[model samples]
Target: MKVISDLEIAQTLHLPNECEELQLLMMKYECAMTEMITKLEVLSSEMSLKFQRNPFESIRCRLKSPQSIYDKLCSHGYEVSYQSIRDNLNDIAGVRVVCSFIDDIYLLASTLKMQDDLLVIQEKDYIIQPKNNGYRSLHLIVMVPIFLMKEKEYMKVEVQFRTIAMDFWASLDHQLKYKRADIADADAISEEMKISAELVSQLDNHMLQIRERIDAGEK
Candidate 1:
């Protein structure tokens, strides 16, 4: 039995009879995501072999849903077409890399950026300068060439590097903000999450320092 994907279900609901082309487009996005994930996995594996440890703890990837793509285009006052998706949306494919230490995030990011095939189009170092709400993560917009059966196409993917503590705090904070969006104490919740984000960053930095000290034979 062929597995029906969520994107297929979404395309059926939104695009109707006009989805034949979009299906192929979605496949390309999926393939691009797969290629990025493989690159990340290989990097992690090579790091483990060389350093006796993996730089990242986990890897996750996702393709944008058809509905999400449509909505985002509409919300941005852009035409909802394949051309628009190619031109405007840089995050059709996303990859999140979670690391054990804050330094690991930077280390992996620098290594990934140095790859010949991957182009770091944009970089956001949120670890050094977090958001007002305390969200901290390194975001990179990377472009890579995806070779198809007939031709090769350059695709953009959004890659995020986060330490385990940063991921933990961000996941919980996102859940609370999403689930409790209309709660009466929303301001208070936002303030509390901001504080929590600061504490998480501090802890991440502290752990990195401890690891550095250990590496330096300081015990």
Candidate 2:
């Protein structure tokens, strides 16, 4: 992958065309995101070949939008420069893994942390300690080495592991946050969503228990 240096971008582009200039830098993040996605897909393939099972149900990758990155840097009071983004933001590239059961989330997270190539820089086990909003997921910030044309660069990519039920609740919760004008009672709906998150969590544990029993019987 060709790396566009800040000097090259600045010299070729005008000052007003900041977004276009930033978009050129996205190639680094794109490469970094693809590297993480490939690792996840390879893990899924190997698991299916060996155990006829996958630790995750699905894998999703995303790169932060140029506008979003600029906004985030301003929000954090950081310098709005390419080097500032690389130095401060750890979630420029993200990979989300949705699992079938709660245990599968852990199984996949532990497996990922064990990889020698990827270094687990930070971990947040929301399953063990649910957030105030009752959100549950295993979040890991991993540092992956992206081998560029001339030099290798270490980039941080956030990996989120969640169960199907957790994802279902989170998706609806996010949509509601955006469609607030359509709701009759915003506070009431927020409360109900929190309750729904709790219910889905309980459901996840029950399903995990049943899965464990089935596996035990098979063994």
Candidate 3:
């Protein structure tokens, strides 16, 4: 069994007042994530009706648990406080949109950016330049407005856009890398995954081209 590290221990030692503050801040992030998901659902519906196809296949969301947040802050050499968490981490709340095709990833991301309420803070195109471990996705850090009972607040949420193939590769890669420790040729496996990512990229592009041609009524 893995033992808890010192960072985890420190994060668990937050004061009572700090805990209350952190709870409220986490609630705000949760609300922000919900609003973003709802916005995407609305967009998905509208796009499906207008274009006769949905761009995204599924939407997945996650909010970092309090313990995870605290551990992250401690790992970054910061005190376990709400201020530190807000300043240090951008992925406390995250949403992932899985699409059927490569073009859908970019199209959905562009559509989300066009919304007046969502303020795009940062964008990273990992699909174009995949990570060494075969990771491929587009990441966006956006600020979304959440209207409370008496106040409107904006909170940051990290959004990721990925194709079905990309998500499949990522899921397997994550499991293989983290779930196993007895693999002998880890480096070789990493290299193979990179090559597989290239193949997946080619497949995505080919399918996208075929889709475009079909939409254009071409044989």
Q: What is the TM-score of each candidate against the true structure?
A: 0.90, 0.85, 0.89
Q: Candidate 2: give its CA RMSD in angstroms.
A: 3.9
Q: What is the lDDT of residue 196 in candidate 2?
A: 89
The sequence of per-residue lDDT tens digits that candidate 2 reaches over residues 70-165 is 678888998877668778988888889998988777767788789888899999998889887778888999988898689888778899999999
Candidate 3: tens digits of C-alpha lDDT, residues 1-219: 123344433456454556556667777888899999999899899989987999899999988866787678878898766677888789989999999998888878888899888899999999878776778999999999999899998899999999999899888888788744567887787798899988989888998998998999943
> Which candidate, 1 or 3, would have the higher lDDT against the true structure?
3
Find the candidate with the highest lDDT and give its number: 3
Worst 10 residues of 1 by lDDT: 1-10
* lDDT, candidate 1, 1-219, per-residue tens: 123354564453354544666667667777777888889898888989987788988998888766678778888998877677788998988999999998778778888889998898999999899988899999999987799989988788899999999999989987788877988998998998999898898898899898888878843
Off by over 4 Å in 1: 1-18
Q: Order the candidates by lDDT, highest first — what do you get?
A: 3, 1, 2
- Residue-level error in angstroms, candidate 2, position 118: 1.5
Q: How does model 3 score by TM-score?
A: 0.89
lDDT values, one for every candidate? 0.83, 0.80, 0.84
Q: For candidate 1, what is the lDDT?
A: 0.83
State residue 19's C-alpha deviation in candidate 1, in Å: 1.8
